[model samples]
Target: MQKPKYKRVVLKLSGEALAGDQGYGISHEIINSIAKQVVEVVKLGVEVAIVVGGGNIWRGVAGSARGMDRATADYMGMLATVINALALQDALEKLGIETRVMSAIEMKEIAEPYIRRRAIRHLEKGRVVIFAAGTGNPYFSTDTAAALRSAEIEAEVILMAKKVDGVYDSDPLKNPNAKKFTDLEYIEVLNKGLGVMDSTATSLCMDNKIPIIVFDLTKNGNILRAVMGEEIGTYVGR
Candidate 1:
């Protein structure tokens, strides 16, 4: 029984991660697997909050078409996050872990509206809260949402779970010679224009001095490892 490095952490998961290998839509197996890991961390006395992206269902910029308005497209992207949140909620509850889905956009029928104090209360009560809808506005990615929520929740760290194992000097898939960085300072990420996260998200984390651990969530039990500070990924922070 190892002690967790972070007592309260925010996990930023892309919607595609929920799809498993299918690359789209929620996979029950993947969802259940993720829920299990979350439960493991919670059992360790870590207060966890999640911010999920909607790339699996839609990307606002990509959705923009010759006829589609940018705002409408972004709204649709927000809706996609809501869908991911609901699916994650189902999976978590099925595992007998208490969870709450809080969206920036008010949709009382589906989830509680985002309120900083209320969300904090949920975390204090040991319930995992999933934040969806991308800041409740357009021209923002869920990455920014994750950063914002991490600051609001006063989380110890942001677990940035991606498809890639770690941050690379170049696209690892395309360049065999690309170097992988095990640790990076906040400025290095911003100075190099690293694609680890959007500039807005990166800037926010740097400003708040919040550490981010980027790793592949597809790896089983990675979440628990990260909370325990097992050195499994690229850590970017002060």
Candidate 2:
């Protein structure tokens, strides 16, 4: 077996990635596929932490644009992330992988409240820790949560699993001639206004000097590949 380049990593999964082709809700097949891939990485002895988004169920910004209270909408969006986290936890557990769903918001009934030490301990013990509900605050994207958690846990990198294969100059789906970048510097990502991640998330990672690998989650075994340093996606760092 090949050794993994990163001993510890934060895997960021957008809710839309969990939605799969349905484009609006969770898909069992897709979740199962993701769970299986995660198992592969776990078997490689890599410590895995995940930050899940809620765009599939709700988007705080979208709701606020339609006149909803911004904070209220964002809180609702946070709740949606918890839902996704539970679903993923269930999937991972079914595959015999020990998983914990940690929420930023206090929801003791279903998940443990976010405790940095506890989360890191879980990773050290070979358990998968899933971070949900963003940073438990409004106006912060889950991408920011991923960056924050990665820094806290001292993760080697952030694996941003997206629908697209990697970062591009334009939406590859819409622009046939869009240019795909093999690698990028943090300044370029911000200066060019690339959609790799939100500015806040990008800046946080840059400040922490954490590298990010943006790759397609739809592909089987891609997670393992990324962790194994396969160079299959856009590498963003200093």
Candidate 3:
């Protein structure tokens, strides 16, 4: 029995990761598998807060580029995150994992309004909290939201779960010679335009002195491995 490295963590799940092999929409198999992994982490006494993205359903940036109103498109993207949050909540609850869906947009019937105190309280009580709706505003990505919420809740680190195993100089799929980086500094990520996170999110993490671990979540038990400080991903810090 190894000790968990962090008592609390934020798990950032990109919308594409939830879509799995289908490339679009929530893949039940994948979501269920993710849910199981989350449950395993919870059983380890690690508090989990998740920030989900909505790229699989709709990308606001793409819509705006196509001539739609930027704010309107971004709001639509926020709605998509809520959908992902609810779907994930359902999956977790099926496995009897206590979960809460806090929406920034404040749909009283479907979710509770985002409250900093309440969210922390949920985590304190051992409940998994899923942040939805992308900060309730446009122009701010879920990546920023993850950083924002992690700072607000004082999470030890952010588990940036992606399809890729680790950070690379280029897209590993397209370039056989791409170099993998096991560790990176916050300044390097910003100056080099690394894909670890948006500048705003990266800055927030750096400011808050929060570390981030980017790894491939599709691989089973990677979350636990990360929690145990097994070094399965690229570590980013000051």
- What digit string (tens of lDDT, one per residue) describes model 1 on residues 1-238? 6799999999999988888889888888888888899999998889999999888888788878656789999999999999999998898898888999999999999999999999999999999999989899998889999999999989999999988899998998899999999999988998998888899999999999999999989899999999999998799989
- Model 3: residues with Cα > 4 Å off, grouped in runs: none
Instruction: Give the 10-residue window scoring lowest on summed lDDT in candidate 1.
Output: 59-68
Q: How many backbone clashes does candidate 3 have?
A: 0
lDDT of 2 by residue, 94-121 (tens): 9999999999999899999999999999
**Could you tell me which residue pairs clash in candidate 2?**
none
Candidate no. 2 TM-score? 0.99
- Clashes by residue pair, model 1: none
Tell me the number of clashing residue pairs for each predicted model: 0, 0, 0
- In the order shown, the candidates' Cα RMSDs to the true structure are 1.1, 0.6, 0.6
- Deviation (Å) of 38 in candidate 1: 0.4
